[model samples]
Structure formats: C-alpha cells, structure tokens
Target chain A: MKTSEDKLNEALRSALKRKFDDFGDQPNPSSYDLIRARLKQPRNYKYLLLTIALIAFFVAGVMIDQHWITTKSDVLSTKTGIKSVMQKAANLDINQAATTKNQLEENDSVKQSVSEPRTIVSSTSTKISMSSVVPALSPATLPTEQTNIVDAPEILEQAEIAALPVQISSISALQPESFKTTGLNLPAITITEALKSEPAIHTNSQKISWLLNLASLKTYQILTVPKSGDRNFQNFKFPSTFALESLGYKVSIGAEKNGFQMMLHYSTFRQRYSYEIAGDEYVVQAVGQADYKIVRPGTIMNEDNKFELLGIGLSKEVQWGGSPPRRSPQRRSPVRRSPLRQYYASAGVQYSHTLNAGPDIGWINAGFGRQFAINRTVLLNVGPYAEFSPLRLSGKGDPFFYQPYRVGISLGMKLVRP
Target chain B: MKFFTSNKYKDLTQLVRACQKHDPAAQTVFYDRYKSKLTGVCLRYAKTRAEADDIFQEAFIRIFNHINDLKEPEAADSWVKVTVIRTAINYYHRTTKEQELHSSLDYTELQLDSGDYEKMMDQLNVEELLSMINELPDKYRTVINLHLIDGYTHVEIGEMLTMSVATARSQFMRGRNMLLKKLEKKGIVHHENF
Candidate 1:
C-alpha cells in the first residue's frame, strides 16, 4: 500500500503543472488577468514610456553638461573667450577703433581685458567665427562704420582679427557638429551656418566667404545597373543591396549678401560593402560601383567591394525671412532677411564620381536645421535632411531589382561668430 | 474588458512573443500559466498572506514589463521565479524599517528521522505547510526558500538579498533549524528526531 505522503506530493506536482505543457502553476486561479488588463492600457503605457524617456533625456543632458563643463584647460578658456570676442566684434563698429582705444584705457573692464598682442590674437581670433549674434544692426551701427573705414586709414585693432582661420578654429574647438565642419577646425561647413559663424567678417562688404563642414556618415545602396547599348543585357538585373561607411569633410567658399547666397560645395563620401558574385542575381562589384554586363543569369562571383564618392554640389540659400532691406527695398538686399533669425534651409544640386573612377551620378538635396547658442561661444546645430538621386545601376539577367531612396541626418556645433 | 482569449498560444515561445507584443489574451494565458507557482515563491519570502499577494502582483508586473529583456523564452519558468524572488526582496526592503546590525545566531543543523513529516504530510495539507513556513522570520524564510527550494547558491542568494555569501548560508541554516523545531513542536516531525 502506498503512503498518503506519495499522494500528497503527486497532487502538488499535478496542481503545479500548466494545463497545456508541464510548466508549473498551482491549482489556484487568480484575478491577475483582469486586474493587469485594467492597469495596462495603451495610453497609460505611452505616458509611462514618455515619462521614462523624458527622464532619460534629462539625465543625458545633465551628463553631457557635467562632462563638457567640468574640464578646465587652456583650450577651454580660449573657447570661452571666443564668445566675448564675437559679441564685442559684432557691436565693435571698428570705425570707432581710433576712439575705442581711448575708452579701453578708461574702462576698467576693457583695461583688465588687455593682454599681449600675440596671446590676444591667438585667443580672441577664434579658428571658427562665433555665429551666435542676431547680426541685426541699426543703420547707424555697421553702415556708418563701413563709411568711416576709408576716412581713417588707421583701421585700429580691426587688423587684429584674423578672418577665416580664426572662425574655423573657434568653431572647431567649440562644436564640430554645426556647419558639420567648416566652422571650427572642421574642413567642411554648411554655407548658411558658415554665414552665422563669421557674420563679424561680413560686417564688411565681401563677395566671397569660406565655409567648412565636419561630419561622419554611412549609407547603403541597392540598384540594378543597366549595361550600355547592349539591349539584350539592358534588362539584366543585379539586386545589389549592401552597406557602406564614410568619414569625410566638405569645404565650400561662397559668395554672400543679405538677400541671396549660393555656394559650390564638394565632399568625398567613402563606402565599404561585401561583394560575393555567387550568381547573376547577386553580382558584387568594386567600392566605386563599376557597370557590369552579364550574358548569363546566376553566373557571377563575389570578390572586391569598396566605393568612394567625390561629390560636388551647387547649393543655394534665399533669405526670405530677413526683414526686407529698408533702404534697398527695390533691390531686395539679402540683408533684408530677418537678421535675428539664425536658422535657414538650403537646397543643392550635387554630382558624385566614384573615387575619381566609376559612373557619375546626380543628386538633388534639401535640409533644414537650427543653431542654438550653448554659451557665448558655442552653438549647437542639428537637423534632418533628404537627398534624391537616380538609380541607373543594372547588370545582366536581373529581371526584378528594387531601388530605394537615400536620406541622412547630421549634427554639429559651431562658434557663434557674432 | 478582455482583449484576448488565454488558450490561443501554442507554446512558451508563442506565449512569450504574445506577451512581448502586449497581447491581452496571451498575457492572460501567461498569468494563468505562472501565477500559482510564482505565488508559491512569494509565500516563501513574504511575512504575511497580504504581503505575499503584494509581492506576487509586483513580481508579475515586473516580469511583463521586462519580458522582452529575457534572452531565452524557454527559460521563462526559471526567469519568472528569479524575478519574483528579487521582487520579494525589494518589497522587503521597501516596506521594512531601517536595518540594524544583524546579531550573530548560533543555530545547530536540523536532523530528521523516521519520516515524521512524511506521516504528517498525510494529515496536514500544503497550505498548512506554507503557513508553517510563514511562521519563520522574513529574512530566514527568504534565505531558506531561495537556497533550498529555488536552488539558488548561497552566493546568488547573498547577492540577491544584499548580504555576504556566508550570511546567506548562515541564515538558511538557522531558518531550517527554526522550521524543524516548529515542526517538532507541532508533532509534524517527532521530537525524538532532534
């Protein structure tokens, strides 16, 4: 005869087993299902998720602040001073330079600020111009100063401000994201962002200004490249979709004004992909995509895969937001654009040649971004952008190939060259 | 309002997938599948029936919240149990007052003879045995259930309970000793076994 102990143990195991599988659960039923349902509404979940995300963002901001602000170095002090120099430069009316030196001696703040010519030049002349100022000038401020520069050949301390390199270095040291490059130490810069970085230089009537952008980007492409003139191979398909990475800088020197501005910008985007030509359906080629002609389907092999793009773009910016230039209303001066508005949108027509080799492709691109003053010197720029281009890639025997559009985003910091 | 029917999932993987998607019926099924065992786990750690209920509810909530973080769906049973244990510990920490120095305890090992509990098993039910477990101090019960029933090593128990491995082992031994004495006093285990 079996002991009741055996039955008790058996009952416990039986009670714990899940109805469908042997997974354990007691015989007791619970109202947890009903209660959890009441508690787990989608709206509640969304709110909870939103709250958590907000907390995370707050924590991240705090962390970034702590990390960036706590570090003390000569580099930091220079970056800190870049903003003051920009602020003062924008309001400078260097035409007053002859009189400002006299005031500098009387004003303790200005006198205290005095230092050796070399240290002041290296420090105040930021590599990147601070683009923070609204650039809004009363007719009496910048316009009058421009008229006086000719009268007084003793341009005073205006000669102390080194124009282009200072803007580049200052912006590079402050933030590398804005203009994406040409601002601080960046080699490539957005045209409008460059405008903001060195408005101090534009305080004069210059036709051309330097722009740089610094950024790292990666993208992928999938297309069927058509073979040339070989009508039989024209329909050949290569469903080549792979990944590529790029780390490059762009540089632009643009002609500027208060109404309309255009820039000739160039960039080199590099890509890396895996190429295995196992069949005609999947043809692998070099990094710079070279057109392939296939006579047979499923008859190719994979070997080398790498592509470099040398891209050139003609970008345009219209300062429609600027207050119509008061005195130059009929002329539509670019200065009419709201001098206070530091944000702008840009569009461009671009061409890319694969690594000084491969097919030349064209793209039309547009983007919108904003610059916020982080401090007197640093400006944070972030934006979303899209680029459209033709997918003229094809190989032999590929009957079905899909070409998808490409889009990307960029973030950077620039010096607020007031 | 019910959004799904509990019996729809075919397997643990399917159930876990449904839960990850926040499928109402799948979650109900998951709850039905694990609640009883998890409640049993809660009983070992909580100081009272109300506390056990609270721990079970909190543990299930946590499990659902982090279901996607579980690396292996097949290991859901062990993972759920571990989560409940941690939740119970957390509940203890949250509800209890400030902790003081844990005075050293000198409890001898408990030895059983002649199958008294086996005989008592015929008379006393599982709920009664659970109640007997509940009689132990909260710390001891947690240590005992985690080490013996849940099969957590002393190091694991210590880490879970925020104590040293030796402390976890000692608490388990002391809890076991105290539980056996209670069983003897209640005649569930014969007094002569000591």
Candidate 2:
C-alpha cells in the first residue's frame, strides 16, 4: 500500500541508514596498542640510564677540579717571582740614566777629557774619579743605586766604569740621531745585572720570543684590498629600478684574480640583473657571481637574484646585508668579528608539485631569497620566483607544450639567529 | 564498539589518553570502537571478506603505531578514513595483476532469480555503494569517490587528479548517474524517485 514514489524515497533513506549501521558490532584486536604500551618500558629504561650517566659525569668533574688546583699552585708561585723581578729591572734602568748625567755636570774637567770620544780609560781609573764627585748632587738627582753604591763605593765606581763603555757602544750602534735624547744605558745595566736577575733576563727573552711568534703566525694575505675601483663598479645601478624602487638597493661588483670568477651587480629594489657567465652549456663552463654588500655595518636587507640554467633549471642567489667583499673566491670565512651578513646563493635543479588536467603535471622552480635581521630576533627575506611546467598551449594536439612562467616574490623569516 | 557503547563521548577521550599512557585495557577499548567501520572500508577495495579482514587488522596496527603523529585528537575519524583509503590503494597495486590472470577463467555458472537479485540489492548500504564504485573504470571511480565520500570539492579533486575542475565535476556526475540507473533496473529503487 505504499505509492511507488514513496517506496523509492524510503529505499534511498533506508540505504543511507543501513550504511551508517554497517560499521557493525564486533570486537577487534588491539595489537598496535599493545606494542605502544610495551615501547614505554624501554623508553623509561633509557631515561633512567641517561640520568645515572649524567650524575656520574658531574661527580667526576668535581673531583677533577679539586685535583687540578693542587697541581697548579707551584707553577703559579714561580710565575709571580719572575714578574716581580722584571718590574724591578725596568725601574733600575731609569735610575742609571739620571746618575750618569749628574756625574758629567759636576766635573767640567772630566767632561772635557771624556768629550774627545777617545779617552776610554781602564775601570779602576774611571771609578776613582766618579766617586770623588758623587756627593755634589742631591740624593734625589742621584740614581737609587746610591744605597748599594755607598756600601761599596769602589765596587760601584768599577761597575759603572766597566758598564759605561758597553752603554756608549750600544747607543753609538744606533743610527746617528736614533738615540739623541733619553738614551738610558740600558744595554750595560741589562747585561751585567743579567746574572743576578736570572728570572728577569728569562722574562725578557720570553717576551721577545712571544712577539716574534706572533709576527710569524700565518697572516691572511692581501689578495685584494678594498679599493675605490670596487666602489665605482658597484655604482652602475640607479638607487631604485621600479615604482617601489625607494625600497631597493644599489650593489657593487669587483673581482680579485685568485680564481676564475664572475660578478653580478643590481639594485635591491630591482631584479638582480647582472651576472658573469663563464662557460658552455653542454659541458657547461661558467663561474656565477651572486655577492651583496651591507649598506650599514650591522643591519640586514632582503634582496636576491634568480639564477636559472637554460636547460638544467633555476637556482637561488641570496644577498645578505652584512657580507664583506670577497678577496678570495675559495675562502668563505667571514672577516668581520661580528656575524658578517649571512646569505647563500645556489644554482641547481629544483622541483615542486603542480595541478593540471589530463596527464599529471609538476613544476620546476628556480629562485632565491634574502634573509636579514629586522631586530635581534626577527628577520625579513624576499626574492624573485619563477616556475616552469609542461602543459597544453591551445588546441588538443599542440606540438610544443605550454611553458607558463611567473615572476613573483618570496618571503621568509628566521625564528633564531646563529 | 564496547568503548563507544558507554554512550559518553568523554569516555572516548579518556580511553585515548589512557592508551597514550600505555594502558592495555584502554587500547583494547579504542580498537573495539573503530574495527568494524575500518573493516567495511577495507571490504570496498578487497575482492573477498577474508581479504577485507586482513586489511582491517593491518590498518588498525598502522593507526596504533602512528597515533603519536596525529596532531589533533578530534580529527581522528577523518585521519582513519584517509589511512584506510591509502591502504586499499596499496592492496590493489599488489593483488591486481595476479587477480587479472585468474579473472580470465570462470569457475562455474549458476541461474539466479530476479527475486534474489532484488534481495541482494536491498541489502546494499553505503559500504556496498562504495564497493560498487570500485567496479567503475579507474579514473571515474577515483574522481567520484574523492568528491562524494571523501568530501573533496571538484577543484581539490582536479588538483589531486591533475585534471581541470570542470572535468572532475563531469566525471563525478557521470559516475553518480551510472549508479542511479543500475540501482533502478535492479528493482531496488522505484522509478518515480530516482
């Protein structure tokens, strides 16, 4: 007694209800659940082992520190004595210069005799003459050596006479005007007392050796010093290339001859339009250039170029804001102490998924992006993007597949700075 | 089903949490809820009930092992649906060539009354609806299944299938119309409504 239409509707509704109920009431195995549960035990065991290892490491570290302190004390004491002796030696040289000047002034006759520059007398004769005049000058004007000199006046005069020729010889060894004023008789004092102050003498030799070692350390060769010509090469582009050019940048390019090279120059606001292409396509011979400079010492900029091979594909050339000029192509180390503007530009094959009708379609994209800090934490990146794919052009059987192209922008950010 | 039988949605969440904590009872409870539904999903792509049962067990095992990869708990139903579909595709790839060799030979022939055909058609549910879909040629079945059952739009199906949106729409409509006619002739559906 149901109408045909009613029966059909009832059938459709019943079919839907039956589908929902078809899930059925039956028990199923939980093998995965069991495995997951079993996995927890091993994970717990791993954590326990890690904890025990860490505690053992910490205890070992404390024990090592205690042992290290005991062994270093002797070395520390020896260094302290050496340092004090060196300080005293330096002070002694200053006193010797003052005493020599006073002795010359007090005896004009002796000065007159010595003035000839050839009156080089024996150590005994010079000592008797200098000691007779020592009391004429104030104690302050005299050298601090007076304390030791008064105890053995004859020994002091003998030491001074013997030391005088050595000092004069060292001074005259200089080019004529090099020791014109304030010439401390340093060589004489340094050599004779060198035996008494062995620690100070050792310290002086060590200081000279340390300086020589520093000088001989492998220095970075001046492959190419930054020059005005480099800046001139960078100024080829206008400040801006497009409507939004105010947001763009101007870049310079220069090459050092250490390696095969090419250069690209462009504005930040414009397409990275310059490139040095050096080789053939089949057995492609080329040196690509993608270098950028920082506008400010520590700021970052978002700019880049897209490097695409005619046959292989596209690649990205990122221009970081703070990169120093490259003196050597092979050396990628940063010269500036602060994190030099970091950027990467690479040219290689790339792929991406695409949606199309008929046969499955995919895209090959070549592009690059720039990453730079807006602040300590946040960074901004932007670059040019291009995509290529094989598809129909117009009719059903076109000879050439449609190779659609798009030039757009890409943006990114760094969550952390390294 | 025992887990869902409690008639409290919160119980499902609690069971999932307990299972995550490695509780055996909770894991068993979680499996009971999804096994039958997953089995039916398996049956649609399988040639027999036994094959369907095997796929059902495999799918559950995979789900349990990879559950930690699921970012949103509430989306578990859709996640399971996609996993089952992917498993069916893998199953089809493995068995199709072997099955094709045997399909050329017929085991036996039997006479069937119109009543029997009608009875079988009457027993059809949504799972059977989906299974009948596999009977369609490859592209049409895939397009229609994606659009109707998986809830993908024509545009999304086009992207997935690498076809235009219009082509996806046309294929889906054609697949549905074919099912409507087949059901109508089997006397399971009355003429006026269809």
Alpha-carbon shift of residue B85 in model 1 (angstroms): 1.3
Model 2 lDDT tens row, A161-205: 322323234333432343233411222222234223222111111
Cα lDDT for residue A297, candidate 1: 33
Model 1, A113-227: lDDT tens digits are 4311111112232222212121221223222322221111222232223222344356446643323422212124333443444322111112343344443333444443222
DockQ of 1: 0.07
Task: Report the C-alpha lDDT of model 1 over B1-194, residue by residue, as the tens digit.
Answer: 13225456667888898888888778778886777667767766777765776677778878888888987898997899888888998887888775442534454433454255445433555565667778877787777667555667889988888889988877776676566566656663433554
Give the range of the ten consecutive residues with the poorest summed lDDT in model 2 chain B. Answer: B101-110
- How many pairs of residues collide in model 2? 10
Q: Model 2, which residues run further than 4 Å from truth?
A: A1-17, A25-66, A69-418, B1-10, B19-25, B45-62, B65-75, B86-120, B123-163, B173-194
TM-score between predicted and true chain B, model 1: 0.81
Q: Clashes in model 2: which pairs?
A: A234-A252, A248-A269, A249-A268, A279-A285, A280-A285, A322-A341, A356-B162, A357-B163, B1-B32, B1-B33
Model 1 misplaced stretches (Cα beyond 4 Å): A1-418, B1-7, B98-123, B188-194
